[model samples]
Target: MERFTPTRYTLTCVASGREFEDEGWTLDDPECGEPSLVRARYAERQLNVRDDAYGIYRFCDWLPIRRTLRGSHAPVTYKSRKLAEYLGLENLYITFSGYFPEVGARMTTCSFKETEAYNVCARRAEGEERVLVVASAGNTARAFAKVCSDNRIPLLLSVPEDNIGALWFEEPLDPCVKLIAPCCGGDYFDAIHLSNLALSSPRCYAEGGAKNVARRDGMGTTVLSAATAIGEIPDYYFQAVGSGTGAIAAWEANLRLIEDGRFGNKLMRLMVSQNAPFTPMYDAWRAGSREMLPYDADQARADAEAIDAKVLSNRKPPYSLHGGLYDALVATDGDVLVATNEEAREARRLFEELEGVDIYSAAGVALATLIRAVREGRVERDKIVMLNVTGGGEERFRRERGNRVWNLRPHRVFPLDADKEQVVRAVEELFA
Candidate 1:
């Protein structure tokens, strides 16, 4: 008889077609000399949701982590009654990842980014000395801060100063997690640059945004949860993406579920959306170009500033990378859509009124796109559809626990154009 084995997933380079073991945080195979997203190939070929495991760890068979973290919860997937009826759909399921406790969502950060933070941070070596560095628009920062703080993992976060308001937490973070921001009016890209510059310090390591298999596979758990609840793959999957990492994760999960042979072997059409005025992916997809069209930096910043959902303002996404969002969309016959602020606000209101929970603006953007798809006849009424509510319950969470929730204050702020030496020195001071 064969022995049971867990945590036996290998990393596969999409570009080089080579498989290798995971060495902590290897985002790409440098030997291949090509930039590509590496995928996790699990040893377990069959779908096995561990009954003993809690939260995201239930899908531990497919995740690329050796251990699970505390306070981690999986996305709550349920067939919608009100939202589905209101949309006049026979099969609409909602995979919600947020703080709607009534429906079993306990993501304290009120975002699915917790999925990334828990898996990514857990992937670190047991005795790693290097400080994990993360760059975020807002939600990612809060998610990482919360997980790293709870587990006492040394972490440094960089976020745009304007979006710092999103760093609210259930309680004050521990000292192990520190935050910094770009002072001179920057966007998510600027936050990435600041964190990248901080990487000059030997003590710092990059979180590897869209390149990290841990992050993608963690986010992929949403689809895993949905598939488990639905008993099969859906006809369409919808999400709002800034970097399109979540959508790519869904695609990867779809492939894995198909391979498992228990779930229906069908590719769900990924209906991803971006907030209007900052819709780079939508523009590129509509133009039928694999290469993203050039949007001037100044104009992108202007557009980013104009959007209500600030998290969806990523100027550069993973669409053009090998085995990235572009490849995933093409393989799934997906389409990118856009939603205006007015449309998104209305969508949020509609969803909250019908579904009995408030959702984030990014989630609103996703629902808005679905609304457009249905009205335009892009999606059939009888088709099975899964809507990924990436974040929500902030209004409820705040209303219930506002007095106890604390803000994660910045440890330091640097000029947007600060050189590497200056940034590294400031970071060194934090650990000193």
Candidate 2:
């Protein structure tokens, strides 16, 4: 059997409509004047699940990767009886991406970011000399660090110092994986800026955030799992977003499923949420603006600091980009919702009590919005709904692992305004 084979797919720029082949990590078409995401056009029109494969690769038919790696886990979807009854809806389902062994969700990182990590790393060409740089809040750093370490892929992660606690791993990472961070008081956007400066090195390439086709397609597997489990696409899809990348991925998956002719031909209305005080996307959507209104930098940082869900703290998200969350919302008749810290906490407690699993702050935000939608009569009781538990089973996973878990300490720390040349030179030396 061939260990490596190219996925039969072509790439299309969402802005220019230019079609091209995958170059492993192509984020956009430079020929197009406007910045936009490039989407994958798979040759396999029908969704095909490969039984021989494991983890996210089970739905590899739609992913943009030349190979699959070890220790990958797919999202698990199950009908929600307890939560469904509590919410008074008949067709409610939970698509979970974490370490709930009872449901067979074996993501040790205990975050849906594993979905993005696995696919993105796999999309890189084998033995590529360039070191991949990624910016993250915390969960994403943990996910990418683990995946790249496991697969022996060279990677550099820039994470917010405040959210560094989220980087605990099941074991020590390989030397090929390195971690860095903006000093305390910085946020996700700061981490992104640090990584951007590091990208100035010719030896480094960016693992594009929302712009990465591999990442969006990777996250799309959550919808694929739900559709395959429920036998059709749900009437609505719910999740919490910092970048709104997962929601866009869900919408893209819905399009592919509709084209597959197996799942029901309907686009699931994306019901995405954001943590209160840091809700730029929600604010933009509600104000009916294509562009994000001027948000003071100090105010944005202050608001981000006030939110419990620190991971949902991207001040500059892909909301206004072509084929981004804005287009996704408009195309699917979606609505952006906001949840307060108090509301999200209550929702988390309720979910754990009813569903018997702890979830991340972002998942709590998602559940809180679903509750709000129910109370506001935005969602009907009888409609099929999928509530995405982006991350859960953390307490349980950690408890089980015990002393085996280790935190990924940063190799270097920089002030928010660190010089670009300084960052680039230091980053290059790590791989040198």
Candidate 3:
């Protein structure tokens, strides 16, 4: 039997509308100064689902990668009868992207960020060997560490010391992965700043945050999975946003599904939520502006610390960027909702009681926002709704997996205000 090879796709700038070959891990177009996010353009317009394939690979035709990773882990969607009844909604689909074995969600990192890590690593593997550097509060680092380690891909992760607790894994750490934490009182943004300084070397490459087309399309699989499970696109898509990249991915995926002509033409209303006190995107959307208003740094840090969902505290998100969260919201006529820490806690308890599974704090914020939307009549009870539980199943996973989180210590921990020379030296030593 001949091996089935997926067609290679081209990268097109969302701003200039110019196309480029998928020669390597390209993030931006040099020709356009304000280049928008790049998208994968495949020759196959209609999605050809491979029933024989597992997880997100089933939608390989849409993803940019030439091959699929060797994992069945992907977002699993199912009709939520219990939660729907509790919220008084007739049609509610839950896309769980965590370690819920009952629903077939096997993301051991317990976050949808795993989807991005797998796709990004696969895309970069096609090119010359180079170490990938990532900065995260917690979940993203864990996701990348797991995927890169499993694939034997070299990776360096920078995270805040406070968030180091969230970097546990079910299995032992791979030798190919290196970790760095800043001991000085810092936040996620500070970690990103340190990572940027470290990436000055030619051998190190940034994971490209929202700028990376592979990461966005990889995350788009959640929408595809939900649509496939529900047999059609939902009327509304709900998620808790830090960078709003996932929401943007859903909008992009919805556009592709609509182009397929199999799904309904209606665009899914993007109803994204942010934890309160640090709701930059929410404030911008409420004010009818694309630009995020300047926020006090100290106050922002305090707000971020106060929230249970520390992952949703990105101060410098891709909200105002071209073809970013702003464009996505405008294109889909989306609304940003805010959830307080108290509300998120209450919602988490309710969801655990009703759904019989523990959800991450960020997912709790999303659930609270959905309930608020239903109460405010922003979303009709009968309309099809897809709620993205971006992370969950940590407690259940610990119970089943013997609470064995990888305890590999960091290669080094730098001060919060580390100089550029210090960061460069650390990167050099990491490779040496």
Candidate 4:
């Protein structure tokens, strides 16, 4: 596969309809004034970056560059005729990336995390000068480890201690990639704290977290890849969002296509789903502001701390950035759905019955949300739709592991209230 090496970045201002160089940051004074977005564009398209001063860069505008390094876990599906006829849309396609024998399964997830790895690593300074710090739960660590190890990019991943078990990859993570699960019991947000500290190190670079263009752009390939397979992008975009990085990526991809004069900017209404137990975004959307409710974050964190899927819940979502995902929702008149545990299971069963596939829990939320949208009349039956099955490799995969799992744990731990200097000492132990 061919990879792009661009010399400069592109800057765009959505509200103003003018684009310029992203010498640094761009501000948006929303006439709406409360909780509006001001975005920073890096290139003509999405670009994933790892710069010392920038923390993360050009990730949004250049997110599309991410699709290059990933392998598929599912197929571009058009077999949902029942769904298609029901949606009342002309073209309906399913972007499936899971573990079924048909789709290639990587070690970490039934869904394709490979898409994230591909884009994150593709746009980097040549000669291996960059270091990426990934904050994940289990699956993302495993996925990123596979990608960084394959690309020989150094990655320092911080995951919650309990979530470590799911870090198993189809193959052993490459030695160059560092794994850092918390030594104590907390949650995904706790792990993110560690990653934030790691990023402050001169030797380490953050994956841009939710802001990384690579993650959002690369993940959007599920949409683009499906669109190419189906001959058109859908009028509605459906996905289960923890961080909602993928939905943002999809919106950005559709924007780029419009800029390329190929696809219309009439994006599919982004129908996003979240686990009901962790529906901060849902609550915020319901209340009519993009602001995060402090009580919801505290409550959700405390509740999810007891479980392993906490990584799927991000307290701070990137919804209000200029041209960010929240903006996408407003522009498309999108709606948010919260999936109950029962609904997720039912959706999973329904999917397995109709599509002959078992999806990840997150994907189940998406499928369930889509069903809810359909049943509740939020989704017009005649509109074109696209559903992104982010991952499902765990249930559908048939591949034998090429390697064995390793007994791993956090490299070190702080007091959870440890200062920066203490964290710095911990990060230095992994240095080459």
Candidate 5:
């Protein structure tokens, strides 16, 4: 077995600015009563891109983990010519996190969520052997499943049965990965509910949603890669939000870049988008309120079902939490845009036609917002822009890899409203 040393870093309370050693795997400051994010303060203040490492690990100086899972897998950033011209933009750049072989984007899961899954597992792998538990609408569960399976790390994924079709993979599923689906009619939130119940077991640990620093920092690499590829910080950053984790990650990454003294000083104007009818963050932000009001469960579920991007339907997002999406948006002077299902569909078609690669529906929402921003003069044509196509290449991936059911059937399926005792029994049986 190859033992790896932990990275040199400290955990700093985002609210108090107090620092502590990387004592263990932690999500929150136990000492602080208020909710706050704990950021990793790396020893290296200056970033020198390591050309020797593969993919996102090249920035391992900033990543929480010291070990490298070198595959040609990482987000690829490039200047857009045809798409830029079509959109009538001068300096449009796209950071694609998918299986676009032409540009060397080899995210086998075809989602930026892979970045979060990889780092979260790697960080925990350095510590004890707790089974990771995660809940998602679709993309995230698949990403976690793929990365955990590839690394031979144990993980339990809970997803709504409606979204289980999205969990297919190109390669055969590893036995280490266990998946549970809620057969009872449930959305993403119900999956989360079941996952929370499942976490009651001592052997299982929550993946800490957006509160996990490793997940945030891992996704932040998209911004870092784009800044390095563009040779400067972009004036505008665009991405579609579910829990707004990626946008928060982008903001955090830009902050580090600004501190590095090489990238431009100004923060990129964050232009995050959400699918319409189910836009909690957008409504809250537009109301100029940090707090998000809860939506009626039935209404939210119906709206989420109607949307083209079901993955962007997080009900209880980490918006108002300290050092979260609200703070990130305020720091960047960001604005949230809403994209209707029709708009997102059109945008997806346009992007695929012009960019020569199929994009995820959430990416279409982001692209639609970019178009809206351009029309509203929120973003100037000449300003440097980084559009994060968070996920894509599903059609291409399926075409090339064929429809081989990796794990032909899920490990188990349970009701969304299953009791704690039932969940615990299922977990015990699976692990036993």
Candidate 6:
């Protein structure tokens, strides 16, 4: 594991809309477009603290539990030239933290969840009987599995069975982490429901996801890393999002850097992309609305569920909060893109051909969004730009004997109305 550090600090409320403290850090509060001024300087690592307690998110260095990239999982090299040409920006850079090995960007979980999982558990209470419970569609589960295995920490992960085997790599099962695959045909929403129940168990503590400052700050490391590699923050930031967590993370990280007196506090124009059928935020943004309709939620979520990377889609996003995602987009003049699967596939191919690496579907969507931004002239070509590729490069992973699945289907399927005792007995049998 890499040594993580903190450069500055601040606090915000998920339930409320207020800045609690800066503690020596600068702030770039974005609601749409670029921040007018920056309190901090540029090109340095910083930590963004949303909540005062729980987890700390360092912007630059991201350590993933006990996993190493020496033999099996090499490293991904960071390259910014190709991305610069695509966005037509002078100092544009691409943050490679997935499967690409040229720059040693080996993120074991493949997904960005590695940012959250390793950071959270690494600083947790040591030797405590901790039962960490999480809800995921796929990527987060894989990240948790890798973390638990590497760190030897006990974890309870719940996910839809359909998404279970689809996770990119099959890591060896760690006895401490139990993978609960939903019995009934379901999606991420169902997984969240089951995760809620698992967290309620006496022995476990739910990873307060959205409210967990560590997860968001951890995910923000990509931005810090990107800016660090490029020597400054970009004018435009782009990515594929489900819950908009990564975008939120990037916004928060830049805000912290602005306060630290090291980075310019310009709120990069965020461009978040999603699969067309499941693009609730994209649809809502296109319809000229800040809030999402319930009907839109159902359609977007279902559409996201219809895809191979269903885990990337989050129904309830951080946009609901003031100065949140919706607030950031509106403030920074951000844009959203919804691409059809066909478009995503084409985008992926184009990117692979030009960049010379296969990308995951989520990355494809993000690339598509970047394309839209470039064509519309939404991005300022002369300024700096950064694109976050969430995941990719499966064909490169075939070298390792990496295919395994611990089939821990829920002990028993339960109805929504299933009595507590019945649920208790079914779970108790695992202990028995």
Write one digit per residue (lDDT tens) for candidate 2, span 1-432: 235566889989898899997766788887878868889999999987865346799888899998888989999999999999999989999999998988888898999999999999888888798889999989998999999898888899999888899989888899999988999889888999999999999999999888888899999999999999999999999999999999999999999999999998999999999999999999999999989888888898889899999999999999898899999999999999999999999999999999999999999999999998998899999999999999999999877766468888889999988999999888988888
Which of 2 and 6 is the better model by TM-score?
Answer: 2
* Candidate 5: tens digits of C-alpha lDDT, residues 1-432: 234455678898888888887656788887878888888888888786766345667777788885765453668899999989987899999999988989888887889988888787778755567789999999988888888877777888988888887888777778878878777467899889888988999999899988888899999999988999999999999999999999988998998999999988989999999999889999999889989976899898888888889999999998998898999999989889999989999999999999999999999999999988888888899999999999998888878867555642567788756899998899878987
Residue 298 lDDT (model 3): 81
Give me candidate 6's TM-score against the actual structure.
Answer: 0.80
Error of 3 at 254 (Å): 0.4
Model 4 scores worst on lDDT over the 10 consecutive residues at 49-58
Highest-scoring model, lDDT: 2
lDDT assessment of candidate 5 = 0.86
* Residue 23, model 1, lDDT: 80
Error of 3 at 187 (Å): 1.0
lDDT of the candidates, in the order given: 0.90, 0.91, 0.87, 0.63, 0.86, 0.63
- Residues 107-207, candidate 4: write the lDDT tens digits: 24554566676556765544556567888767777777776777677888887777777666555556688776566555677788878887778888667
From the highest TM-score down, the ranking of the candidates is 2, 1, 3, 5, 4, 6
RMSD of each: 2.0, 1.3, 1.6, 6.0, 1.9, 6.8
Stretches off by above 4 angstroms in model 1 are 1-6
TM-score of 4: 0.82
Backbone clashes in model 5, listed as residue pairs: none
Q: TM-scores of all models?
A: 0.97, 0.98, 0.96, 0.82, 0.96, 0.80
1 or 4, greater by TM-score = 1
Better by lDDT, candidate 5 or 2 = 2
TM-score-superior candidate, 3 or 6: 3
lDDT of 2: 0.91
lDDT tens digits, residue span 177-205, model 3: 99888774678888898899889877888
